[model samples]
Target: MGLACAVAWLAALTVYDVRQRRLPNALTLPGAVIVLITAALAGRGAAALLGAVALGALYLVMHLTAPSAMGAGDVKLAIGVGALTGAFGVDAWVLATVAAPLLTAAWGIVGFRARGGGATGRIAVPHGPSMCVATVAAVAVVVI
Candidate 1:
């Protein structure tokens, strides 16, 4: 049930991000809260919640330091991701992190090819969708 909810949440986030190129805190905040509470109740403990917050902060720092590479929206979305993956433990977080960038790179390469290499740098991608795919793939790989 938790996994299902996480999947749906990621899907909704992806749609919103793709449409608006922003991940509103309105979505991520509530999602972070809910997932954290759920994980705590399910025996994952408060550590997961703290981990999520830390992850958000880490992303925030990256966004501030390299705004061209990271965005506020991605930082916000990381809150929910941190909660969900942290509940499962470090392996999930590692998988998601590794997968997200690799998948993003792959998508970027494909887009570059499709565009005849005209996009010089930092093409705006609907990264929420890429994250969603990466998160799901990570979960699948870890679980199966």
Candidate 2:
């Protein structure tokens, strides 16, 4: 059940990010809640919350320091990212947290080079997809 929810949640958010370049509160806000509810049922609420808070804080700082570099939607998406991967353990949570931004940065560099976004001052990459991908990869690591 948890796995299914995570897969569906990741898929929805990823598609939204790719197409819209933003994660709607409609998906991100409720996603955190759903992840927490399932985590609580699994007796990992504390860890799950920790993941959400940690990742959210990281993205929050990134968004605060550089508005163009990271968007508010990414911060919001981090909540779900944290909870889902955090439930697995500190390892999973840490991996997801670290991997997401690294993935985004890599993609940003590629996109910037390929399409020439240097004139725009910043390379725009949808971070929600990175977060979603990292969470799924981390969870898979823990599960298998």
Best by lDDT: 2
Cα lDDT tens digits for candidate 1, 1-144: 888988998889989988888888888888888988899899985667866887788888988998978788888888888777777777877788677877778888887777778647446566677777777777777687
RMSD (Cα, Å) of candidate 1?
A: 1.9
Clashes of each: 0, 0
Any residue pairs clashing in model 2, and if so which?
Answer: none
Clashing pairs in 1: none
Question: Best-fitting candidate, measured by TM-score?
Answer: 2
45 in model 2: Cα distance from truth in Å? 0.7
**What does the lDDT read for residue 5 in candidate 2?**
74
TM-score, per-candidate, Cα-based = 0.88, 0.91
